[model samples]
Target: MTSATLHGYLEQSARRSPGTCAAVEASSGRQITYGEIDRLSSRVGDHLRRIGVRPADRVGICLPKSIASLAVLFGILKVGAAYVPVDSLAPPARNAFIFNDCGVRAIFVEASRAENLRYELARLAAEPRLLPLDWSDASSPLATYLARVEPEGGLTVEDESARPGPDSLAYVLYTSGSTGQPKGVMLTHRNGSSYVDWCSEILAPDESDRFSSHAPFHFDLSILDIFVPLKHGATVFLIGEELGKNPTRMASVIAERRLTIWYSTPSVLTLLVEHGSLDARDDHALRFILFAGEVFPVKHLRRLKAVVPRARYLNLYGPTETNVCTYYEIPQTIAEDRSAPFPIGRACSHVKARVIDANGRDVPRGQEGQLAISGAPVMLGYWNMPERTSAAFHVNSSGRWYRTGDVVIEDGDGVYTFRGRRDRMVKRRGYRIELGEIETALYRHPAISEVAAIARSEEAGVSIKVFYASRDGHALSLIDLKRFCAHNLPAYMAPDWFSHQQLLPKTSTDKIDYQHLMRME
Candidate 1:
């Protein structure tokens, strides 16, 4: 592996193995080798420069998971431009919000979404040039024009070359915020490349290993699923979003593609278990399962382990700001920890983690505190929003560190376990409690499968509103669940209102969509 510099990393890999596989589309099965990626991305850079796109300008990508997406990304960065990844899978409003907020100057979108792009561009206060991408090999009418549009009026080639700096913006990833607005996290070139380097060091996946590119492009988790394989010169089989909606279909794609690596939110795994389908396990092709985003339901983990117990199960923890700050390889003991919500293992070697009390001082061991991370993986800040950025990426009086809103505790062994969220701490019956703490207790019941704890205030008392997903039509009454919680957790943390649903609402990245759920009657 080379240095963490973005261009240096991509350039070195291109030099080392130009013929190795770089990217492949899950839907069309189109593949691009490192050599093709280099050439096309170079051409794309040249094309962008020709069109007056300069360094630091935002370049929006609205394409699907395809070779072109990878090429365009490398190309945009090659031209010293920051890329804003807008998920084609995302809602049009969300996509439009990202583009407008970031002040994108150029866009690359799939032909299927070309109309939407046109409408959005028309509606924009200022219209940026929209480039329509065709996945097919054949040239479109635009290609002829694109060929003729070389650095037009630029006058010289060397002047238009891509100029990239490690500290410069690499991407702007949008995440749903508590206020219903999408917060755009601006990650530097180093932030992304450093993560790739760290992951490549931690899990040395090689070319022979074919991985799944099922995670959506918008999510940071897609880095491992998409780029890590490319960085290692490995093949990545694409699994379409259509198939991903049906876990069985997704599992079938995994088995069919003979995927060896997977990184997804635990909710997808829960869906697999609830459907009683382990498509990949039957074939035994999957050897690695790297779950991130949210806590994994232990029941599903046990079920999955029974099928592929030998598979390396890693619980990865991080925010959109930090690609991945910590990871814990499944210990030999697969038994559920009934004590806390779930242990997120230890902080990654690249990160400095501290569990601090409200006073911003380290708490005694085993005491609950907020988890703050200081590392290269921590994002530069929110794009152009200094106040919110300052709030998130702050240095304590002692040193420089970013405070992660998550609460956690450190064990004697130095391994940290997730406690809950700081905001989740709520006042109930004159008692302050963590809703996540109560939800963790609820899921421990054998009959309960997946559960979410929401704070609801009513005349009866301040109690929790739990939405759960159970297996095989199993049900747990509100009273029974409240009793179960009372036996395990404190009275203040117990839920009085409970709703059992087959599936919980999820975000675009597939984590439990709490805001959407809050809207549910």
Candidate 2:
């Protein structure tokens, strides 16, 4: 059972603990044991092979968080292919762009979603084959496909062959691109294996522990949420998208499911503190509270710590390209002092990180600079984007480093603190959104002559505000623009507030003064 690939971890775990719970649906109370997951995923691998899914090919997975999604993920990996997860809540156009951009020839979806994607599939120049897993009708494609395939116990010509190696691509997660398109971040098994290996050492999970899966599959944080638990034979309690938005319900589900490990953005913690009624509540099952994606407000962190005083809190920091390169263990003193932002701590065991100045040399202690990470976990690069990939990384005498567009200040103690972003990307509610992407979507509207989007801190988290100019004599309303954005972008990327302006503020050089707009907020 010794294997190097990501899927092999699951196979090893299943062999070690066949009867242990692998995942559970919080809403439906449905559970999938490790034994069933392995057998079912093997069947999925066989099915995918019959459909000609080749090793190194990309396969799209658009199902919601459930036992089926987990199976489909491992199944895709079992066949030596990577799964491209598109958020089912996102607009079809966005998903279509991802599907085409990644050149995915096949997709696994729910039956209802398959019906909705009929038109989107037709729109694509090279339509991908559909495998709707939720459909139960005997005439359905999934049923028909399964009927032709032999049982798991039966021998398969394709099953005897070797699975993908550690260096092979495991998944391609698409993130908001600055040019109105989404860029797929290509990560290999080596990348994920390093992360999971590091996680096992830091956050120890056993068969008695239960994990809370709050992040969507598209987000990198989900890697730890799904794989770490599976690797250790623990149960993963899935929090659906709807429940995740309602912090009160999410808190209730956590207590009910007895989730021992909680991981999400600070915004979610803020929501739980303000709305979920977590203060003064003693839910001792939550042992590890891991927050990433954004800096948690000191006040909110203080309040959360007061409620879950015994729980160990860790602030994880990194971009999707490198899944949590650094982590800070929030000491209890932070609940009182609250003088500085939590340090991003040192690099993980598998990574080497440095703060470099504009000239690429290491920045002096206590000075601000961009973070450059070099490690096995660093992504392969943006898929099919050689120029951009080359531009994003730098080579030094030591090794190759991925230049994270994030700026930070490193202390003499080697602790890094968050400064700001070098680019237009903003983290809100665990989702990384590019302001330029929103502006580009707005610019496509016929009535919008000019547009600029900015993120402002709100009560719960960050809010997006868009300032737009209308075409001559064409009056624009917030309602209309909201509707337009809803049609094109995901809900998280949509503007929370809109302002119509005849002329946006500009710098002396005639460039849009984003700082002025941010101050106006």
Candidate 3:
């Protein structure tokens, strides 16, 4: 109902519902009212100013998903600085690479994540500077850290006087990298706010709604989780860490807290069902179960419907470059559409999507091609790679289209179905990955000869399947391969299934035939 920027939205909410719960970390049983968040974020912003973090200086934040993370994000924006949210669980090298690539002026990290953060920073061949934020206490570690970084409180004259440009970078999110190197996507305030507006309206929940956030803070999905409730005067349930890690604890949370709306990937949902917690004993209060970041398994969707008869099940589709574009809302009272592959649904207002052939021409209805999305939500592109940014961010020959590399087919009904990626992309449990990126990591191993990674979807959701041509033919066991992957890559990016192969399928150009490898599994 509000057509405002993210800052405006939060400012308005704080004005109206000063005492209403703005954010909470269920893991620590801590809460921050909207007014408190406003005050704290501004104070943190003041601290940043005292330390000389000027407008648009990249400030890196690597923290657990909690009240502190949210504060860091808003606080960075308040000073007109852009935030680079690094997933705390990300591999140490990945964190270091992103920080170095973005030229982060300062870094705030949780104490638990400090060991890896420092290791990666030290490993960097370039500037090894790292500003660490220890989050062992305080509502948000950044809040207290900023307090120390700048002793004199109160917003500086420049901080209070400067205005935020609509096109200025709001935040940067580093998603799965195809080159085994994550890419930093710069999102402007307009892009982020427009997406926030679209979601708040489409979901259409008022203050009575309680949205649960299960996605990691760095993921774009978390944007909706953090902003939607604030955009509407509603409460957000930040699931505890133990609950996030252990399925059993989450079950108890659902029954005990009576959460109203839920957002997560299929992997987490499948875990809930597998653990035998998808029963009436759970809170019937969960009114909606929304899935995105990857494809949803219809069978699991069906199973979910059987348990929560009143919940609305929605399939949200979009890449990090753009917020959600298409959504399919299937109320739990209705059975799943298992007959035809579910449509990705229609684009939201200000968003337009088309299926185009290889040359970028529109395909006929019902034909398969790449997806091109045009709208305010189009990302500003990779932070520093101009050539890459130019190739991915395009001005349509017709002058108004940004192409998304997703291969999909458009139906006569104007809906789209995901075919696969035209690039080295893989979506597992709502996370987009680049197999080349994994291969890059594997090649780093002196013991590995050659390797390729791909995603395999199963009843258990999605797991990475890796194939290798080892140098010694020493019977690279799954355990060993996995151990190597864990040592060098993030857990989510690790290949779950390892297979030994003498050679891999190749095309006429001698390139790896990913399609053929997908068939062997």
Best by TM-score: 1
Please count the clashing residue pairs in each candidate, in the order shown: 2, 0, 3
lDDT of 3 by residue, 1-521 (tens): 56335666777889999999887676666888989888878876766676678887888888777787787778888888888887676577878889988888777777777777777777775453355666655555666666666655544777445567778788898875666567998999889888888876767888888788777767788888887888787888787444675676776666666777888876577557655465747456887788886555455566667777777788888888887888877643434334233567777776888777766777888877788888888898888888888787547665556667877777777777776567657677677776655766676555555566787778987777888776575657667677878997887787878888875554221235566788896
Question: For candidate 1, which ten residues in a row score worst on lDDT?
Answer: 137-146
lDDT of each: 0.76, 0.81, 0.73
Model 2 has a clash total of: 0
| Model 1: residue 38 alpha-carbon error in angstroms | 2.1
Residue pairs of candidate 1 with colliding backbone atoms: 26-238, 50-151
Summed over model 3, clashes come to 3
Shift in Å, residue 418, candidate 3: 1.8
User: What would the TM-score be for candidate 2 when compared with the true structure?
Assistant: 0.79
Report the Cα lDDT for candidate 2. 0.81
Positional deviation of residue 37's Cα in model 3 after best superposition, in angstroms: 0.7
Please provide, for model 2 over 123-205, each residue's C-alpha lDDT reduced to its tens digit, 9 standing for 90 to 100: 87758888776545532334344555545344346644556899999999997765657799999999998999898889877
TM-score per candidate:
0.91, 0.79, 0.78
What ranges in model 3 sit over 4 Å off?
1-4, 122-131, 137-155, 159-161, 280-282, 331-340, 424-521
Candidate 1 structure lDDT = 0.76
